[model samples]
Target: MVDNNWLAPVWTLFQQQPLAQGIGLAAMLVGISAFRQRDDGRFRLRLCLYQGAIAFHFLLMGASTAALSAGLSCVRTVASGHTRSPWVMAFFLLLVWGLGIPGINSPVQWLPIIGTTIGTWGLFRAKGIVLRLSMLAGGLCWTSHNILIGSIGGSLIELSFLFVNCHTMYRMWRQPLPNPS
Candidate 1:
């Protein structure tokens, strides 16, 4: 097991800056997706497992976004019925969060420190905006043709969505609210 030095790397992750965080978060999603994504069903089972790893890594980033008003899982929580077999992706995200035990809003996204800050607001509204924004950013990132960097930046959109879903679920159950007029 690691000691104090373990925390050292936590701070060291690309999460210390806005661009890094954005690029890092996106890359993480692509990495996870690449780890599992398959154009064909030649390896459905394996790809499924790889997808989980991808989600898990993002989950780590989400947990790190503490009180930053951003948690990708919260978006996932909001968009449950829209996707197919999302629980699988969601579970994988949880795995990484458990492993990393990271800090909040630490240079994880690109332009935004905690993209989920803005994303959370949009996702919480429960409109289609979250997915649309995610897709749009991802598309723009792809069109930029930066290859590796773009892939990461783009993929972050989905990664954040996955995190927001689970995060919100926890909040809904954990935090109580007062009656409204």
Candidate 2:
């Protein structure tokens, strides 16, 4: 409720510094690489938890600068050509934009909740690896949201899950790129 201006650009020492920009670019590269490698994993994990992941990323739009940054970073990354590489992950991004972006200035933060509930069935019915990862990603999504919403344990837990998720994704990337559908 307080006016915490997270978006207000502060003129700190490193404002517009080349190092910062380069760091962002490098991180984007790494993030992009990480994402590319983990397409199936991210897709699998998120697919496993698609409903909740969609809800978590969607409902939390504009809730915090961190949320916005992450959300927009997702958009920009896709726009910059990562999500485009793997078509399935694009569906995940679509989920983010569809249920989440409109919440930027609206009161309907619960849309994803309903959508995810409906969507979860598909994942639940999915057999084998995809289904399993979806379940894990869903739990991760829920936990990430809880952490973002002020759960102290959530952050720590999310970080650990993220570490594993990232590791798996990176490994997937290191392997040969799958045949694009």
Candidate 3:
């Protein structure tokens, strides 16, 4: 467990940046919008918008790790829509690990790194139920990470995402597959 003291300064910093937090909230809303899109292409496009907003929010709040990961996520999300090849998926996973290495200085940092890794792999390779399930795993990691970073909006976003995404997944499962011609 991380020391509690680490959060005090972070909390103070967050309190000072309401605008950044607001942007994060907006990002979360945008992300929820993405979940409503049943089409793969539409989903990826909305995710790109969410990632961009989140990147900016993290940048303003001085959370370089999450910010960079979000930026990379934007790229990864877009690329995944164009290609679902195993090679491309491997490259994305490697990229997450490569970038994570330099940024990881302590155990706490690992939360986002792990989350991003899971998210990158899932977002890039998985489809249908597997994709959402993978993202749920990633969202859990991010929940811990956002809390550690004192990101109020980020925390709410992940928690809400998990709930909403799960509900969406359930709905998808309930729907019958279309009959083949």
Report lDDT per candidate.
Answer: 0.37, 0.40, 0.82
Count of steric clashes across candidates, in order: 34, 5, 0
Better of 2 and 3 by TM-score: 3
Ranking by lDDT: 3, 2, 1
Report the C-alpha lDDT of model 1 over 74-135, residue by residue, as the tens digit: 33433433443445444434532443334423333332223322332332333333433442
lDDT of 2 at 6: 53
> Which candidate has the top score in lDDT?
3
Better of 1 and 3 by TM-score: 3
Residue pairs with colliding backbones in model 3 are none
> Against the true structure, what is each candidate's TM-score?
0.26, 0.27, 0.87
Evaluated at residue 108, the lDDT of candidate 1 is 33
Please give the lDDT score for candidate 1. 0.37
Quality of model 2 by C-alpha lDDT? 0.40
C-alpha lDDT (0 to 100) for residue 177 of candidate 2: 52
